[model samples]
Target: MIPGQGGIVTRFAPSPTGRLHLGHAASAIRAHDFAVTRGGRFLLRIEDIDGTRSRPEHVAAILADLAWLGLRWEGPVFQSQRLDLYAEALAKLDAMGLVYRCYCTRAAIAASLSAPHGPEAVYPGICRNRPRHEDTDAPHCWRLDVAKALARTGPLNWWDETAGTIACEAAAQGDVVLARKDAPSSYHLAVTVDDAAQGVTDVVRGIDLFAATHIHRLLQALLAVPTPRYRHHPLLTGPNGERLAKRHGAPTLAALREAGEDGRALADLLRAGRLPTGFSARNA
Candidate 1:
């Protein structure tokens, strides 16, 4: 399952919650290049399951930015339009008795944990055994019972471009939410299902998501979908060496374009392992 073999398919799935930033450009470039050089397909997926944050304006901006970068893709699939598909996958998990309703709020979960641990606090599984009532309308999310899922799938491993073969540690994150109360699908569920539907053979993105691949692998096993090879590239950072983030005032691709910076040139530089003056790269 390597790129350039068997008609490699890669994607740059970005959430339309904000403008596309330099960090996103690096990822898009890598994924696009991987497909183009290997004579394969590159896809664009809009991960807009969060209705509260995702905006049409932002999506348009993302398209404009990618076009500016001279990157092309096959299908610009929108997750919001594929709610039924995610629902079908979730129903399969539910039918297997691997999905449960969780009523715990984020603040409540944080309070329940004695001490914050790991990159994210492990979900305490407060509602794992709660009986579901058909008529109940309480706001709750659907979560995957990781222990039960792992029991069915046994041990799992996924290949990473840089890290090589990695064992799955889905339990470390506890029972993760698969569907949100506010949205029909969660990031974990939508991404796994969409990747499978799109026939994505490779996943290229920032290393910040390396930990998430574990949960995704488990989902692929549970849903009986194909698992793709992964390549988690280094994240771009500001001149101060801090990771680029919206909170840190990282400049957006739109801003750079408006400032008369050459988008294609920037893409070329990123492809050559060179970065702009105020940006740097670091392995996450």
Candidate 2:
């Protein structure tokens, strides 16, 4: 249990691949405010599972940016350091027959997408029915058995501040990746395990991650871990009405910071107009 906290715990999990942008700032502020308002713990988890692109410099930059914005977290737990924890969770799922090795290649999945337009490229379950090989020397990614996972689990339910009562049945979400063949672990496995480790009971993020909640809930059921309440804020958009990303050059927090802009002023801009009153998570 989180010390000195009542109700539920919240966390801000960020990928330290680039400088914190306006979208990130909004999410951070919302999460910070939510935790403080409810007298709960506000935690931070650096999503550095993608070792190829993640860097220590980027992680330090994230911490510095959050600090400058007055968003203090319990810690800066690096996901890279928690690979063993994720592996343990994956092992548990495997032992329970909820997860299986997926031999399908990305290219094949993409090709299959063209054959029949399905809901969000649902996994064809090519490997779902295949015999689980005890010894596989070749490369393979691990995927959860959505059918069994659903049978063992059930329809997932979560409360979103903006969207309101987001629900999804297991049949719709389908099988999801837990770990990658290239990387040691996938986002789902790493995030679910990390949240449990950090004792996070509430998740504050962007609506862009809303769909991912289903996968998270499924994992929680398979691992018998408690699911956290969710709030997906609206994503910050660019002049073209697209989600703010590394591709957008101007209006970037790094650029503005370099121009000697105050963190508070930038935070105001992130709100898009008036300073958000009464604490609420925005979608991104």
Candidate 3:
């Protein structure tokens, strides 16, 4: 369902792989404000897609961080609990010949990408043609047939509050993984399915996910699911001007709390992109 068509229903689906950081607080507050302003429902879904890395303690810590920030959610729907739903969706696409098994290994793809002029590493449509390969009998994940998906979904275009009008053709993204060789679901498949199931109307997130929007849009059409309004906020950057990532050493909320940092101060720092003590390099 689209925002403005009805009351908004937003969500903050954070994977509890690590402790929540300042960036998490920013997105949470923005989502909460949007929902509160419109009297919409705010949902908190635990996106623990990578079970190998996610822990119950991490999820509990995330819930605590949100509570500390004064952001309450309608739920704690763990993505792990909804594997069956994702499997059913994949099966439906597969039955329609819109899903196929792929057996390409990551090392093989890396070798191809390293070649001078090899085919673009974006799934090269390898499995698209060899739909009945022996790999289908072996271990394999599923990928959506872009041609059939586009035919079913039509063209996609949406307006974003921060990024303005955006449109993308399915062909540009190429065929993407719907499920992993090791797991029944991939990020793209599970997210789209869960968003539709939860009736998410507005998707507010960091700009890093901007490129993935096209893939998600394609899946929305393939599933006949209603598209949500999107708002991609500016991302938090590190001191070296690189996008913040888990491996880069994040300052966690629990540590900050132990250091006696105020949540309101963190909120203000997020809004202004500066330290809460009012020291500004630009102003200086």
Candidate 4:
């Protein structure tokens, strides 16, 4: 059943894999303000589906960071605590004939001579038709057969507050993994389930996740969940024109706090759509 039948809701769900950085701050503030200004609910969901990378300390720091930014949220739900929910959703998808087992590894996909399809090495159905066996223990993942899934859901599209109407081009992503060997649900599946559970009506995030929304919209239809209104805001980039990332050594909000940076002031600058030195915002 679709949620969001009540008041508007928004969320800032971040995986507790690393410290919250400026990029994280910008997204959180926008989501929180959107809900609050509309007299709606703002929720915080810990996207700790990655059991391997998520850390407890990181979650704590995330709350602290958001609070310092003058943003408040309700029910900081932990994905680790919602495993059953995700599993149930996965089971529903599996029952539908649109799911399949994929045994291809990243190395194999990269080494394939199929040539890169797009920005991401979209899986080229390496194991879509591979013979399935009863006893073989090869590591495998559950992928959504985009073609079959679309057939079930039909042509779909989602509204982007910034980019306007956009059709679902999930085929460009090929068959995306819904469940990984290490995680019960991938980002696309988990977020779709979580947002519906939380009754999220509006989603404000970075443009970097724009393509994934296509997959999410399709999943929402397949799962019979409500599709939230999306606002893919510009990403905070460094002076070098690269997206701010943990690997790039983006300074954590905690680090900036320790360095005596005024949290509220920084948040104000972000609200005003301004950036500090050596940083800028770019849209996709």
Best-fitting candidate, scored by lDDT: 1
**Which residue pairs in candidate 2 collide?**
233-282, 233-283, 233-284, 234-282, 234-283, 234-284, 235-283, 235-284
Q: Which whole-number lDDT from 0 to 100 does residue 256 have in model 1?
A: 91
What TM-score fits each model? 0.95, 0.88, 0.87, 0.93
Instruction: Give lDDT tens digits, candidate 1, residues 13-96.
Output: 999999988899999999998988888889899998898999999999999999999998776899989999999999999999
Supply the global lDDT for candidate 3: 0.77
| Candidate 1 deviant stretches above 4 angstroms | 1-6, 117-119, 133-135
Provide the clash count, candidate 3: 0
In terms of lDDT, model 1 sits at: 0.90
For 1-284, candidate 2 gives per-residue lDDT tens digits of 23467666788888877787777788888887788777788888889989788888888788778777766678778888888998899899889888888878877777766576654678878778778655375798888888887877667676767667767655566678888988889887888888877788778888888888878877877787887778777776665567767776525556666777788765655545443232223334
- Please give the distance, in angstroms, between residue 12's alpha carbon in candidate 2 and its true position after superposition: 1.5
The residue-by-residue lDDT of candidate 4 on 1-284, one tens digit each, is: 11232387889899999998999999999988887877788898999989889999999899888888878778789988888988898889878978888877788887784665544777878777765564266788889999989988889989999789999898888899899988888888889999998889999999989989999999999999998999999889998888898888789999998898899999999999998889998875
* Model 3 Cα lDDT, one tens digit per residue, 1-284: 12233378889999878888766787888887788678788888998878788899988888777777766678888898899999988988887788888777766656656455434356666667773745546777788878777877677786678767788666776788899977678888999999999999999888778778888888887778998999888766566555555676657787777687777667756666674332222210
Name the TM-score of candidate 4. Answer: 0.93
Clashing pairs in 3: none
Ranking by lDDT: 1, 4, 3, 2
Q: Predicted candidate 1: what Cα RMSD to the true structure?
A: 2.7
